[model samples]
Target: MKDKYDVVVVGAGPAGSITAMYAARGGCSVLLMEKDRDIGMPVRCGEAVGKDGLNGVIEIRPEWIAATINRFRLVAPDGAVVEPDIGGTGYVLERRVFDYDLAMAAVEAGADVVTKAYVNGLWKESVNGQERIVGVTYTWKGIPRKVRGAVIVGADGVESRVGKWAGIDTTTDFRDMECCAQMTLAGVHMEENACEFHFGSRWAPQGYLWVFPKRHGMVNVGVGISGMAAKTRKPMYILEEFIKERFPRAGVLTTVAGGVPCVDTLREIVKNNVVLVGDAARQVNPVSGGGIAGAMQAGKIAGEVIAGAVASGDMAELEDYPRRWEKLRGARNRTYYRMKKAVFNLSDETLNSIASSVLKLPREKQTIWGVFRTALVKRPSLILEMARTFGLKERE
Candidate 1:
């Protein structure tokens, strides 16, 4: 690896790889580093992406997809259910292959990609009486190496240290955190073209449980509980118990555990010469804790901004990263955060009632947006909030 580059992005996930690819394509020397020996091994995500969201950033390749989803069910505690079409499309990705392909794309775009490289610290220097990160120090192949860059991008996941090291406050409140556990199971009987979500204190305790199809006869089932509730019962145990009762004979294929930040986007994402993206910047949806699409979108913007700065030798351009992201997604995410806070407080009976109401709607009208409005029945003012955010008439 070179001793110096224009951009150094940590964490070879979708966000980091896309950032590296775009920056390199923009004519910046970029380095992408991954601590894992394989780019996407031991995947930590739910592996689902919205059709429009995915297409907005990258072209969808048939090889990267495991299952196609056109509809989803939302089940309440009382078994009241509502089926909603995702506008006839979505995909559950084979994240391992997808991430590896993204890294290779970055390499093809002129960035150097390295695996098994763990970033241990940042390279900082005193500038105008302040410590500013100029690069990073990482260990590759059990050997330490230092690389300097004009800009640094931290796409590390929720447990990132790079942002903190760069003096950005990356702390999240326990209430806003969802402790998650997932298992890929075979021998499960579920719709191969649909996904399922269960909501109630019993099922997930303030968060939600999801069952997404991986392929025929295979499903990814998981639960995300509020951090506070998770202290009382492990998320894995909760999911396992649910599975035993729901699909007793299912065979486990793989298990994953992690945390999802379900809060409003951070007020700050850029610090001096460094910028945080993906989970590091809390870009995940505050309601669903979905970050794949958000990460890729943020990475795209960050790359363009940083590359422009590098080319012009004006690092101040980095500030555009957060502004652009807020315009693109963070603003809507804040509305979702408000909706989450309001909905998560409803009684189980209330959620069942909402589900029942949604079920009564015309199939075409029983959309996610309809579900959101149903959830806001008690907090009707939030309906106005949503309308304002989306430029919809209050009646709509």
Candidate 2:
């Protein structure tokens, strides 16, 4: 194996694989590394992704998908349900197979992939009294090896060490983190074409529960709660209780528990020749905590920027990657973050009142945004205040 490469991507998740694919295809020598023995073992995500968000990035194969979705059901506090017809609801993916396939795409694009490689820390070189990233030192198969590259991308999941090693503030406050727990269950009766979401303080204060149907008469049933709420009640206990009561007849297939960053996108995701993408960049949506699409979008932009910088012999151009991601996701994140705060702070009575108002709306107008707007309509003063504070425009 070569001792060095033009680009080294840490982590083999969606972000890293996509970045490696684009970089290698653009004529840059790339090395993609994964700490785990497998690409997507021990699945962590809700495994749901929007179809529109993934278009043009990669083609979705039938084998990679468990089921296709066309509708969504939002269950509010007091068990009031709102069914909305929407396009591009997305698919429940078989993440283990899907992730491996993505890494294979990178390899096919001319990048080399190494698994069971753990990066201990970054390798730095001083040029003109300026500390610059030159490579990374990692242990692969119990043997220490060092690989150098012109650029390093951190696509390591939510708990990323590369970003911190590169001097980026990757700390996420408990108030801004969602404690998540999920289980794949069989023999569950659910709408295979419709994804279900249960919301409310009691159900998951500051977060929600999701039912994403998959193949073989199974679905991924999960709950994500704010860390603050988790302190009072363990997330696993909550999920277990919900399953016992709500899904009495279902049999568990697999269990997964982890945390998702709910903070708004970071202001700085780039420095020197290093760049952060995916969870390392805090690019997940604040409201939904959904990151698959956001990661792919950022990866594409990062690849373009990195390629340009490598070709120009000017590393400063890499800064544009973070700026571009901010431009694409910052506004929506800011809005959703503020909205999440306000929504979580609402009292049970207030939520029930909002639900009642939503029930009054015509069935055709009972969309998610419509219901949210209706709930906030009565509190015009608060709405204007939130808009001003969050720098959001008042949308009717």
Candidate 3:
């Protein structure tokens, strides 16, 4: 790699790769680094992404999709199921292939891509009594190397060290982190176009169980529980018990365990010459524990902002990153975080009653919000609090 570049992005996931692609396309010299030997090895995601969320970002390859989902089955504690048709379907992708393809796109766009390069920390320098990021020091092939840059982008995951090294507060509390365990199983009987979600404090306290079908009768069954629940019992233990009881005849293929940040956006994500994206910025959906779409969207914006700053030689232009992201995604994240807190605090009786009401609605209108509103309508105080918290009145 060169001694210096216009921009250096850590991590080669969707966010980092897209940032590199956009920056390079805008005519900035860019370098994208990944610690893993392979671009997408050791996958840790549920692998489901919305269709519209990825359309213009990257072209979808037929071989990368395991299944296309159009319908949802939301199951309550009492086994009450609400089926709904959600248009603009989603897909469970082969993340390994998908990640590599995204990185290749960045390389094709003129960014240099490197793997097995671990970033130890940010190289900081003081310019005129102010701290600024100058470059990164990392170990590659067991040798230390330094690359200087005018800008750095942290596209790292939830536990991002780059942000911390750059003085950005990237800490997430246990309550905001979702402990998850998933297993890909064969011989599982499931509908190809239907995704199942099981909700209950018993099944997955503070979170939910999901089943996304893959090709050839294989399915990815997973559960996410709040860190509080996980402290009492391991998330894998909860998942194992549920699977043994529900799918006694299924065969396991692969297992994965990881944490998902279900918190609101970080208080700050950009500083000086550096910016944070993807889970590093806590941009994942607070309710769904999904970050693919948010990461890609954030990467696109960060890329444009960084490119402008590099071209203009103005550090002030970099400050626009957080403002743009907040305008687009901050309110939704705040609303979802509140909704998650409320749902996790519900009693089993309340959940059952909500499920019954939800089942009474037509499939098209059977949403979690509908159930929440129906069950809590009698308590006008609670309704009003929710309305104010989510800015629902403005939406209405």
- Highest lDDT, which number? 1
- What is candidate 2's local distance difference test score? 0.86
TM-score for each candidate, following the candidate numbering = 0.93, 0.95, 0.93
- Model 1 residue runs over 4 Å out of place are 127-130, 378-396
Question: What lDDT tens digits, residue by residue, belong to model 1 across residues 153-242?
Answer: 989889888989988889999988999999988998777888899989899889999998886688889999888888898999999899
> Which 10-residue window of candidate 3 scores lowest in summed lDDT?
377-386
| Regions of model 2 farther than 4 Å from truth | 378-385, 391-396
TM-score of predicted structure 2: 0.95
Task: Output the worst ten-in-a-row residue range by lDDT, candidate 2.
Answer: 378-387
lDDT of 2 by residue, 169-239 (tens): 89999988999999999998777888999877767777898988998789998999988899898778888
lDDT of each: 0.88, 0.86, 0.86
